[model samples]
Target: MAKKKSDGVNKSQAIRDYYAANPKAKPMEVAEAMKAQGINVTAQFVSTVKSNSKKSKTTRGRASAKKSVAKKPAKRATRASKATSEVSLDSLLNAKKLVEEMGGVEGARNALSVLEQLMD
Candidate 1:
């Protein structure tokens, strides 16, 4: 077991290095290897350390120089027009029921015409 300095920072680096060296090694195996070298760590701890190392590495160089872009809001009528192109199964069933209640297909068409006028 190698003696750590005043702070225990090297343990995390050692764990990360072990993961790099044996990418397929299980968490328990990593813990046991650390145990052999006189550092006590759990499998969960190993997983946490590994994940944090990955996160830190990914975020290190990307935060400062990035620019935030303001996006414009989309037009509601355009979105609604796009939405009307596809009819879902539930909507079809409801339309069928409404047509039956109105006494037939012609009644449904008349109802739809009134609804379209109301929307405008």
Candidate 2:
């Protein structure tokens, strides 16, 4: 007699098949469906599997893949862009390092001003 295969063995592929049958099904819905059929799985686990599948199918490296993401079409600008008021601690430290590299903040500003003048 052949040994029985464990339900967990193909759980991710099962989830994908379920998604194909019900295009609108969420990860939680997939988990619930599997539970109804006596297969135990959590929604989070299903989500992780689905995400991993997507990441695996991407042919491009991370940087190019990120850049290729589709953006919404431009809309009319009704308001001026707001300046960022808060700086992250990490960003502040990075900026401090950059300033040191350029001698000081004044030196950095001078370099930026030179760049701006060149752009004009």
- Best-fitting candidate, scored by TM-score: 1
TM-score for candidate 1, please give it: 0.45
Q: In model 1, how many backbone clashes occur?
A: 0
- Candidate 1, residue 35: lDDT: 89
Query: Candidate 1 lDDT, tens digit per residue, 57-81?
Result: 5346535322344434432332224
lDDT per residue (tens digit) for residues 29-116 in model 2: 9999988977788999988877776674556553345446665444443333358566666556656655765877998899889989
Clashes of 2: 0
Tell me the spans in candidate 1 whose CA falls farther than 4 Å from its real position: 1-9, 56-120
- Report per-prediction Cα RMSD to one decimal: 17.3, 13.1
lDDT of 2: 0.74
Model 1: worst 10 consecutive residues (lDDT sum) = 71-80
lDDT of 2 at 55: 70
Q: List per-prediction Cα lDDT, in the order shown.
A: 0.76, 0.74
